[model samples]
Target: ETLMEWQEQRQKPHVAIFPGFGSGHHIPLLQLAKQLTVYHGFSVIFFTAKWMGASPHQTPPSSSGGMIRFIELPDVQIEGDHAGMSFLVRIPLLLEKANILVEDALTSFP
Candidate 1:
């Protein structure tokens, strides 16, 4: 970025937060997200994989507060595996897709 663009961006920093697919990860991650928005002046987007939840019936929660947003992908399926195992196998694919999403989102900035 040019110096002018960089200076303007600091006025509205953007952070993309994608924690691991378990609560042991998401809990602390959420806290960090809160701090980044509340203290650091960053706008953050939190991504959760489609299958991640305490129970299958539970829906992914949403945050409407300014500077924070949440998005969830559709669940992945791998043939001939138990549900738990499939989650681990699907992580890499999801990460790749998320990276693409991030790059696309960045292009809209500036």
Candidate 2:
């Protein structure tokens, strides 16, 4: 392995990061993404709820100096007819949807 190989590897370390449902959850994740991209030369894809403002702050590698990106989540709704376990039970379902979104984003990465 040569220095060029190592540098190329550095340029290609991709990561996808998502935070849970609040600003408290968001800041820490964003800080870590910042460190990973700024200090370690990582390509980061950061996920935020659509309500959390993903598109405005997306910093994809092609778009800026910082290789951190933000992908927005779609609004999730539970079917009213199937509301047995209450909204709490629907949380995981929403996360499942988010996981699918993440998987799709990953597959689309080049």
Instruction: Indicate which candidate wins on lDDT.
Output: 2
Tens-place lDDT per residue, model 1, 1-110, is 57985676567877877676677777777778878877777777776665555321143234424556666555554455455566556777666766676566556544
**Residues 5-104, candidate 2, lDDT per residue (tens digit)?**
6567557788888788666777677778878877777878888776443333543344334577677767766556645776577678778877887788
Worst 10 residues of 2 by lDDT: 55-64
Segments of candidate 2 deviating more than 4 angstroms: 1-10, 51-64, 80-85
Give TM per candidate: 0.57, 0.70
Clashes of 2: 0
- Local error of candidate 1 at 10, Å? 9.1
**Deviation from native of the Cα of residue 66 in model 2, angstroms:** 2.5
lDDT of 2: 0.70
